[model samples]
Target: MSSRRRLLTASSCLIVLLAVGGTVVAQMEAGDRGILPIDSTGTLEIDGIHVDVGGKDAASARYAGWRIAQREGFKKLWAKQHGRPESEAPNLSDSVLDGLVSSIVVDRENIGPTRYIADLGILFDRARAGELLGMSGEVRRSAPMLLVPVMISGGTATTVEIKNPWQRAWAQFRTSQSPVDYVRISGMGVDPLLVNAAQTGRPGRGWWRNIIDLYGAADILVAEVSVQRLYPGGPAYARFVGRHGPDGEILGGFDLKAKDSADIPRMMAEGVQRMDELFTRALAAGELVRDPTLITVEPPPPVEDELAAIQPVAQVPLSGIQIQILTRDDAGLNNAVAQLRTIPGMEGVGVRGGDKGWSILFVNFRGNNVTLASAIRARGWTVSDVNGTLRVVPALQIPGAPSGQ
Candidate 1:
């Protein structure tokens, strides 16, 4: 073939490859493979409630066990709250108990023709139970903190990049008893692209601030677990570390071992409980304070004298305010755009295309460029106006963020 023909063929192949890549990315975005967190909010969960009962049939036996679990769980909850023995706990009718119990969680169970033996979790309606205990249900909680459960195995660290037992344990944890207000994300949609193992290593508070704000959290909690497999289907050990903030200040750490692969879930559950305890203690010690750099302190009001001296200026809404976001890839472009749309006064935000490593977004604002810049900066993005075009930069040196086209 001629050189010109060869060049044309290669260009066509490149276009086809680009199209296929774009399709894959788009499909990943639309896929629903992420795990949704269990809803155990606003309920006091009493785990390790054991019940063994027998009946004429398997279903009847299971029902009897669940009823007995409600009674036993109530006693445990009373002792937990009042520091009394289970025998001293007051009794209520089965009908009343039914009203207080929210759901039954089967921790472990065995079923036979006429018997049911199980360890269970009982969720109690906090308000209803509190009324019976003659106390308030209110509990002091810390500022909202984003939880990123990182699992390290085979020298590789991952968080929601792939489903693992560690992530599942954290997602299933009941937060009603925890003092830390943990904001958990279902590792779906673009979650893996955003909250990954590499993201925890980023030390920029500015970048974290943006991410935390997206989740309506004030700070971050890094729950890291390193798994050590002794052998195939043998014992396993895991080291867990609870770190705080973008700097990864160590709150606490511990080690756990599982007897075998089947015991891994139980081990992970214990790890999560211990990790929550560490966070709780850290919060009590005032160690879980939000980073000052992450908080956006609004500009103070102008004094009366300064305000009086200022001349009134006509307000003009800005249109076609070009924002160039620097990005590493298409994911960064999507993230930057999502963050920008959250800022107030930005309307009809639309991408205007850009060269490699950057994307241009044109938005109509309800205010001027100065107000727009202030809003963008509040979201932890570095913004500057150059020749009427706004250049927005991410705090972390991540590619595909705000860079001019």
Candidate 2:
């Protein structure tokens, strides 16, 4: 890769954040259990269970006891970790437990009347299950994450509590357990409305600082969610954009499949759970420590503590869409991504499939086409969006002068 600088004045094409719908975790197997490893601390999963009992039928007896045994297993694991008796662990829900289980191992079965016993290895995506068990590892008070949840419904965006269910959920989320310090404005009392869904595309950090200060937060996470239902009162597919509030740089994007509108909040809440993990990982890896240039008040000096080490994370799934840059050379593409990262919440930029004269870079960013385009415009880049596909070029000189509106 050449580090050559081009005489490109600036690109007018706005940054594009794709709202990916459906299962957001890439290559994740069907159902709730994650095939990949997520964590190894705090919450202990009940894996490899060997229980034997006799009932009307071996299968039915063993099946019936599965629930009781699962609860028992969880309690046992909790007791081992917390030094409390099995009876001390909080009662857990069967439905919740069922979701965390990934692969079940069964072998060496013996059957009897209404009773069956075998070996079972019940795996779990401990990252998600731990929350249900109220077993959050450790929390840090270094930064207060300002929550700006914007819900887009009926083609309109809202932030006020009455209309935005996403924001409402964030406000209600118990942030005490998580490492990230969370801050949110209820839009109550004398609060001046400054941020909306659209401003996330702006290239500069000017607008974000005010919003951060409005809620007295150290930083901000713009939780942008778009909900679409095929039929009224039916299943819903939600697209989530988690971006930095400072510069609208995308931290990550994901999709949620909800049974219906009611489930949207649950899915969103889970999405937030992952978002916290991502942030925690970044912090643990020393990737997202405060930048003094970011805020007027600097974050407290980095405290060497055990909190960061315990917050584990899985392979972060990226939700992406690509844009074409007319200049595809190594330097041009590299510089393009470099510039993009300066915008704040950009997750990453990479050449995914192929590169023509136009660099086909998969931009893992947040926000929609409009916000991206607007941000590009702010940077003085010429942008063209045709049905959500973006093509951008420098404003200085082109053979045809950057075609398409």
Using lDDT, give the best candidate's number: 1
lDDT value, candidate 1, whole model: 0.81
- Over the stretch 117-187, how does candidate 1's per-residue lDDT look in tens digits? 98888878777787886667467899999999999998999888777888878877888778889998778
Candidate 2 lDDT, 290-331, residue by residue in tens? 545457766688877787867775643444656766664677
Residue 81 in candidate 2, Cα distance off native in Å: 7.3
Off by over 4 Å in 2: 1-139, 202-207, 289-292, 297-405
**Per-candidate TM-score against the hidden true structure:** 0.65, 0.40
Model 2 RMSD vs true structure = 35.8
- lDDT value for candidate 2? 0.60
